[model samples]
Target: MFGPASSRSRSAWRPRPAPAARPGGVSPRSARRASGSEVRTPGSPPAGPAPRPALPRAAPPRAERTMPQLDSGGGGAGGGDDLGAPDELLAFQDEGEEQDDKSRDSAAGPERDLAELKSSLVNESEGAAGGAGVPGAGAGARGEAEVGAEVSAGPRPAPLARPPPPVPGWPRPALPVPWGTHPSDPSCPGPRAPRPSHPLWISPQALGREHASQRLFPDKLPESLEDGLKAPECASGMYKDTVYSAFNLLMHYPPPSGAGQHPQPQPPLHNKASQPAHSVPQLSPLYEHFSSPHPTPAPADISQKQGVHRPLQTPDLSGFYSLTSGSMGQLPHTVSWPSPPLYPLSPSCGYRQHFPAPTAAPGAPYPRFTHPSLMLGSGVPGHPAAIPHPAIVPPSGKQELQPYDRSLKTQAESKAEKEAKKPTIKKPLNAFMLYMKEMRAKVIAECTLKESAAINQILGRRWHALSREEQAKYYELARKERQLHMQLYPGWSARDNYGKKKRRSREKHQESNTGGKRNAFGTYPEKAAAPAQFLPMTVL
Candidate 1:
């Protein structure tokens, strides 16, 4: 038999022809080359492509016909020939893709229309409800209407073609809509197909750095139609009645009786930067809102045609609030009750000293700091001016003198004095002390123990049984307090606190000698009364 190596020797080399150039710029030779296909010389019949090595089995396709996709191009039961000409195959593939796109877009149409309908409904409700504006604030109301019109007038973006639909018979997942939205309602448009969620790709580090940046300003107030109407020019024309400057109205208005005061000519209503209608300038909501300027009449000229005494038929809301619906012609008016004088009126109240006349000084007066006594003093140099004495002996007089023995004790003092002056150190409370203090009243209330001595004995037993960790917690607290104590009272010793007790005891010992029973017989000059004879018999 031939040797195994000889039988397996490599086959002889074969040459491939260059592809022919065609009008379509594609050739059969190039197509086979691109597809990685091999062929024998032309004189020999070309062999059929060897059966493709079977691929690992895949799951079967869904039974129902739906959208087409790139992956299914070759795997389907029917397909364009694998060895077909490149240009023809490419043309077929393009047509298939276009058909899939059309089918997907048709399915997605209803969903887009639904979303737009919902947004429109929300904008309409907002416009209809209006804002916090009062009944007849037309400027504020008009602003809202314009905003709603713009929203309704906005152009919609074109719908894009989708790639493909999901496998048929799969359960679709639901998404949450914003509050008050009705997705499935027949009145609202339904989407042709579900829209896919697209996620944004932001760097986490960048997001964190932005979050760490310092806050530069407060959040701006939400803009509303009412916000733009705050400008005096916008609001000044709202009311039909005349509005007068309060100060001028009070000063220049004629009294109830006929008087001959000439009315002051009013200044023209000009939009001068020097003086604005409102004391504080109002911020405009948007630049465009004020594009058209209209004449804003001054408040004083608004209602000159209507006189003050005329009665109104409707409710009067001149006050900031509305009047209660009660009786007609019940206009609120000021009542005058004779009030007693705030201070008693006496004969001395008849006169007040008039202000001094101005001198011929050239400039405005500057305050003089000279004392009244200095102003009245004469040149006669007598005894030094009497020292000013205090009006009362105040408790703060002690502050004038240094507190006795208040300075920290010095080492130079004798041992006896130093020991006597040492400050008393209050014993720091341990965990047991705190526990007992808190529980003493509780124990009494619960009737667990009546006597404090019994409670103390039980508390001691419990404290001894406490775990090391529990005991350490309280010890740490006490240690902190001890450190604080040393800082506050650096030089104090025990003797200072106990010394007061010893001093009181010494004083009481000396006083004891003066307070005993008096002697029965008179020791000094005073004569004792003669002893009275006693009757022995007792009265029955």
Candidate 2:
């Protein structure tokens, strides 16, 4: 593989070689020195391949500022050549590198000042791997002979090159407890694992994508996101995309059918008026109010006692007598009722009040009124009837033929009335109430009979027999829970304040004391909750 000695006597298949050193043993670099008069031996190899062009001098390797003349890293591929570089060449490299250092230091001075920021949040003393040096600068790699720590004659080894820390000025994770510092892992510890870095928030686009996936694939997801999020919470968050319709990206539609159009795909016509008459209510709106996903998890008294369905029809109240004292004297046989039940008083009375009564004796069970419109008193501005609340009749529905009865109510009206009857203030639970509430479901689930009334009796007797200390503990828990409730529902005060005026007027006619005995604690029962406002509806 050397000069003319190699590949000179080639095989017939090989190309003829160009002659070298034709008149003298010379090459291009030395050709200038070779005169035409010079001669060469026939067997001598042509001058060795002309010296390869001197490589452009390499940029000096980065150096650390510490007291080392060598880097931990060795010369990468050509360690031997680096060791044998000429003395002058090595000296030149040293000069160049020193100049580069001066230039970089001077230039980076202003940049470093600008880079330094005041972030009190990040502790400076812990993990101090950044912010004091130029980027990409490091201890220059030198031969082992010049590595100060190992070499007897060399200068001291430089400080270890530090990695850049988390980019300055961006918030970093909360500082972790150092190894041997955490209280729980006290024994057999070396270095502690770094604390997990929880991002305060992800980018909106990424969050939105996750939310969309969860919304579209609620029960059967493509993949579980390992965000350490509480299970299934993001799946139905109130703030997540609430308006994902038929066109959102994650929502898929069926591919267009190629099976051809149906000849009679149109639906059959039905009487629209009767469609809702017997619809079974699509699992009842009551199911929506249940905390249990399945409606049957709790007793009927707990979940089904309120909001029970009522027929839409108004009841026959022709036999109902008014609640007024009989000594007021004989009243008229004909009275009136508000058609929409009642309306806020204004000029436009879309509904009229009328109820024709049957002939009545002086002491008839049904009472009459000359001014039933004013019977309840001045507070009620619209036509007043025997009813507490009346359903808004449809514009086209048949009118009720009977007199108004306070107990007669439609489903919607009954719901409104029940809400009205609820107490405005949340009654603080006693030990018994809390115990019963907690254990009621347990009893229902465990008992063979599963009768709510039977469960209630057992609970009542058990509660009476509970030790005072045990009861006190539960009572304290209930108090804390109630406090937490107030914290979570700060606006409950506003809900409790609703319908205060109506309550006052309704209570005005009642007696102060009941004939029944007070509770064992000598406390009176609480009054009803805030009344649900029965907003008047339009016929349309």
Candidate 3:
């Protein structure tokens, strides 16, 4: 039984070994039974029953066998590769890379966006400020649109209205006058009636004879004249000359009362013999001077007596010769009469009488007065002797007198001298200058007193304590003050003098204090300067 048990144990162990082969391959008994004989082929190991096809790997649990999509696509390569990497881990790593890339992209994008935003904002700001269109609008396109719109709107305004052109060959139209009822009246004209060529109108009185006589002849009439008409010499032939002369004479010598009372009668022509002797043919003195013809004088005696010897009755003379009865005894009866000499009359006697003889020959022009009567005589009638009558003959016979013009010159010179010697009128003073002068006096007095006090303090009882140069400086300062005061109050000399005296006294005292310190040249030594370091940089 022991032997069989041992054999059985060996069989059991062999079987155990055989069972182990089952893992490697099918069991030998099963292989022999299946293959008919456990035959070995040449050069090859005996193949037992197909080694029980690897248990089909139990189809690896469905989830464990499937790898993530990454493993299939070249994800797992080496031993140390992340094959065990969880899907979440791989996804997390991928997500982390994506996040990093996104972060970089976000940062870069923000920068790019910020730059773009900044550029856009800058463009928008420029556009708003410049009144241009939005930034993206092309510049050339926008300008063209603006120009096209402006041109399409309207034509440009004209510069200004041109003045209406002047009418050809004609003046501006006359303003229309309103028509009245009277159509044919000259005063209510469409165009004003042409002004009369001679518009002057004369009054009836101005055309009368007495008015004419007064203007043409201002002096006394010739003694034997039949009628007083203007002398032929006085006629001004030219129209303008006549008008001017007539107007001037009318203005200067106005018509007298009753001058134009009667209309002048027409003149009749006279035979030569019928004409008055006093109207003997004469040439005007003016014509005689201009013409070559010599004037023939009338017989001297006949011409002299012609107008002068009017028949005077003795009774008319006796009326002016009345004398007092008591003065008759004093009158002498026999008056010596000088006899007339027989010599020929001198040529000078021609102008000696009250009237001059007519110098022109018969039928010549009438004579003009050498001096006009109005110019000769004073207008006053009475007191003729006091103011020299024009007819009075001077003893010397020469008409002009030396002292005549001298009187006006003497009077004017005297008046001018009197005016020159007159005292000057004082200008009126206002309160301001007076007040200013008073204030200036007070200031100057106070200043002088203060200066004296200062000098006195500096000198103490010893009045000559200061050096000459210091005295000069003090006096100069005082002088300047006085001068300033005088300038401020222009005419205040008294105050200025007082200040000057005070300054002078201070100067004298200073000179005395600096007792003649002599240098080698025998003059006072110059004063030494005080130490510069000790002095203040700025003066008070």
Candidate 4:
């Protein structure tokens, strides 16, 4: 009678047996019998029986006993109690019906919901994958959203396409090159090659710009002449041309018409309005003193003013006449003849007829008297106004001859007087004779004094009693003095004829005094003569 359905029902409701004993050897059944349960019955099934025993009084199955343990372990004590109660059994049956209803609802809608969830998960994964490629995905999404909003308001334009990736080995887009510059790439436009820095033409533009920026603000500009010409903002092409034109005009053109000329008129005087208030007129002390209202000048002022006019200086008339006169103590005179008788009216004489009067007109005397022609003229005689003849006349009461005529007469008289006086006087003594006379006298006096002194010294020396050495020294000193005097004044050794005569006379007298005796030195007795001394002895 164990149909599949009934068996399933019984299995579900069965109580569990006690745990089997472990391998160590205790039996749970025996333990249970010992704890006051029945141990055995006469028709009980064996322990190893294939079929289970029949229930007593229709009790629940043994498996049903394990349900509380399972429920308690899985759920709690309340779950164990619920598993044992009939009401819980009914609630569980209702719970099963509710679960069936939920399963049915899930089955009915699961295909569309699962598909929607799978699509959302796929979109998230793809967006995350795209995040690796895009640099700012969130920002891009925000931008897209904004663009969508714009589109909703009106038709949207397409986003601009990104530029193509830079090609390898190709040059990147170069910055704009300045004028006269070549790009890093040789083929680029402008200059064909990079220019080396030129020493002479080196540009100061960069350095100048830096200096200009530091020194000049918006209002003030550089004051340098070059800077003004080169300023980029100035009128184009005008600066260089204007400067060159100015230079050329300065170099080539004539100076301005009024240049270096005196000014035509004085500058207009400044009016009171034109003058600054702080300026005051400055008057020099001299000007102020002169302009003051003083009636009389001071003595110092008069003296200062006197310096303006100096006395006129006159030439020396005596010195002028002396210089003009040809001979000493003479002056020239001229006389006009009626026309020299036989040599009548030569052309030169006719020329003299028209000559201006020698004295000039009464109001205008001749400027100078010493004319060359007037000094050469010959003149008439006897008239008081005429030039006197050299042979003249009366001693008394005669007017003095003209200076030139008088000079001639004086020269003739001087010659006559000189010839007449010449025979009366004897010839004059010459310098050589005078010199001989003077020298002879001097030599005689000196020789006499020196000879006397030597004699006295020799006699006084006690010659008979003296040693040879003492006598020799005295003699040597005398000899040296004589030699020195002769060397120093060679002119004193009188050698002329007069000197010789005087010496001879002295020698004769000396011979007489010595009675014609010759001394041991084979010389006559020495005459008294002075010791010779050098002239101009002060220097020594």
Best-matching candidate per lDDT: 2
Best-to-worst ranking by TM-score: 2, 1, 3, 4
Tens digits of per-residue lDDT for model 1, 1-540: 111122111110011121111211222222222222211111111221111101001111211212111221233233321111111111111323334323432432322322232223211211222231211111131222112211121210101000012211110100011112123432111221121121111111111111111000001111231112111111111111101011111111111111112122111111111111111011000000111111121011111221111111111011211112231112111000001131111221100100111221124242232321121111111211210001111111121211222343355288866443332233333334544432333323222233454335323322322222223323322322222222222332232243243233323322343353223323421222111111000100
| TM-score of each model, in listed order | 0.16, 0.18, 0.11, 0.10
The local distance difference test score of each candidate is: 0.20, 0.22, 0.19, 0.19
Off by over 4 Å in 1: 1-425, 448-450, 498-540
Indicate which candidate wins on TM-score.
Answer: 2
Question: Could you tell which candidate, 1 or 4, scores higher by TM-score?
Answer: 1
lDDT (10s digit) by residue, model 4, range 1-540 = 111233322332233242121211212222222222221221222331111111110212212221111121133234322222221111111223334323432432332222222112111100111111212111122122111211211212111001011111011111111112112321111221221221011012221221122111111112232222222211111111111111111111111112213112111111110110000001011111222122122111111211111111011001111121122112110001111231123332221221223332234223444321122112321111221111111121122323344335455467746443221111111111211211221221222222222222212211211111212222222222222222222232222112222244334433454455222223322232211121011111
- TM-score between model 4 and native: 0.10
Q: How much does each candidate deviate from the true structure in C-alpha RMSD? A: 46.9, 42.3, 71.2, 77.4
- Model 2 lDDT per residue over 385-498, tens place: 211111111112222212222234354366655455332323234334555544444434433224444445435433322322223334333332332223222233433433
Per-residue error for 406 in candidate 2, Å, reads 28
Give the runs in model 3 whose Cα sits over 4 Å from its true position: 1-339, 342-364, 368-375, 379-383, 386-540
Q: Candidate 4: global Cα-lDDT?
A: 0.19
lDDT of 4 at 7: 36
Residue ranges of candidate 2 with Cα displaced over 4 Å: 1-302, 307-425, 445-451, 488-540
Segments of candidate 4 deviating more than 4 angstroms: 1-461, 491-540
TM accuracy, model 3: 0.11
